[model samples]
Target: MSTERAREGLYSRVQQFHAEQMQALDSGRFEEYAETFTEDGEFRHSPGRPPARTRAGIAKELTAFHQERFAGEAVQRRHWFNMLNVQEQADGTVHATFYVLALLTRPGERVPEIAPSCLVRDVLVEEDGRLLTRSRRVEHDHVPEA
Candidate 1:
């Protein structure tokens, strides 16, 4: 494949990956959310926090986060990612940056209000014809007080 085509393909897959992950997590499908990553993928939410380094660990964290933040009957959250940039890395992984947002809807809400805005960096690898996240770094732009 031409280099440009290869990048386009990878970029598409990465976008799909993020979309699936967001859907799974938003719908409380924790296992599906974890499956979006490699078996030993790393999810670093903050520089000072320990990374979730395995699928099980990832699921655990997701469960906790969802329950604590969005479990109330009146609260709902939608996660979204827009591909901002894509590039091939020297280590045979695809590096992508996504403009990420989490919006919350409450009981009286007409539309979801944006809460957390971030730039998410994903290092992705192809495994068995499926793209998976090897590592993800999330940097926040704004986080409204809950």
Candidate 2:
């Protein structure tokens, strides 16, 4: 295959991976979402806050966060990604960046509200023929990062 074709293939794979991962999170499958990350994966939800390190730590935090975010509420959060840019790094890792929109839908609401739009950067690696996120950083568009 030509280099361009190979690159497109990788991009497609990354896009599919993100869709599945986000769906897991949206469905309250925190463990399944965390499993997409590497064992020592790091996730930084914001620029100021420290990253949630490790797969187990990520899962724990997300579980607590989801519970708190929707406490006594019937709201669901869905993640949408767009304008994905994927690059094959020299070290064999894939770098993917995209805009993420967090939409919140209430029990009786017909339309979902946009919570925040963010720019996410991720470093992905393949281990045992499986793609896993090594690190991720999220920058909210409305918030000024210091």
Candidate 3:
């Protein structure tokens, strides 16, 4: 395939992966959310923090974090991604950067809390003819007050 086509294919695969992950999160399907990553995939909420070392670790961490943070709170979270840039590596891996906007809706709340969009920096690998995330770093434009 041409370089352009290859890049496009890689981007499409990554987009699909992100979409599936968001859908799983929105539906509260923790298992599906966990399955989107490779066995050794990493998920980090911020750039300075250490990434979850494995898929199981990520799943466990996220399940606990979400349950505690959103306990008994009805809310919908969606991630909007844009400005995708990808670079193909010699080892059939891709490095990507994309901006993301996370929208949160609370129960009976007409307006959602719009977070300052963040950037998603990720390393993707083609394993067994399928694209999988090896690492993901999320960097916020401005840290929100807790």
- Top candidate by TM-score: 2
Candidate 2 residue lDDT tens string, 20-131 = 9999999989899999999999999866768998989999989787777788887888899999999999999999999999999998899999969899999999999778
- In candidate 2, stretches whose alpha carbon ends up further than 4 angstroms from where it belongs are 1-8
The better candidate by lDDT, 2 or 3, is 2
Stretches of model 1 off by over 4 angstroms after superposition:
1-8, 46-48, 143-146
Candidate 1: Cα lDDT at 114 = 90
Candidate 3 lDDT by residue in tens digits, 12-117: 8778877887788777887677677788888987556567768788888778878987888888987788988989988877898999998889989999998868
Global local distance difference test of model 1: 0.81
| lDDT for 99 (candidate 1) | 87
Winner by TM-score between candidate 2 and candidate 1: 2
lDDT of all predictions: 0.81, 0.90, 0.80
Clash-forming residue pairs, model 1: none
C-alpha RMSD for every candidate: 4.9, 3.7, 4.6
TM-score of each: 0.83, 0.91, 0.84
TM-score for predicted model 3 compared with the true structure: 0.84
Q: How many backbone clashes does candidate 1 have?
A: 0
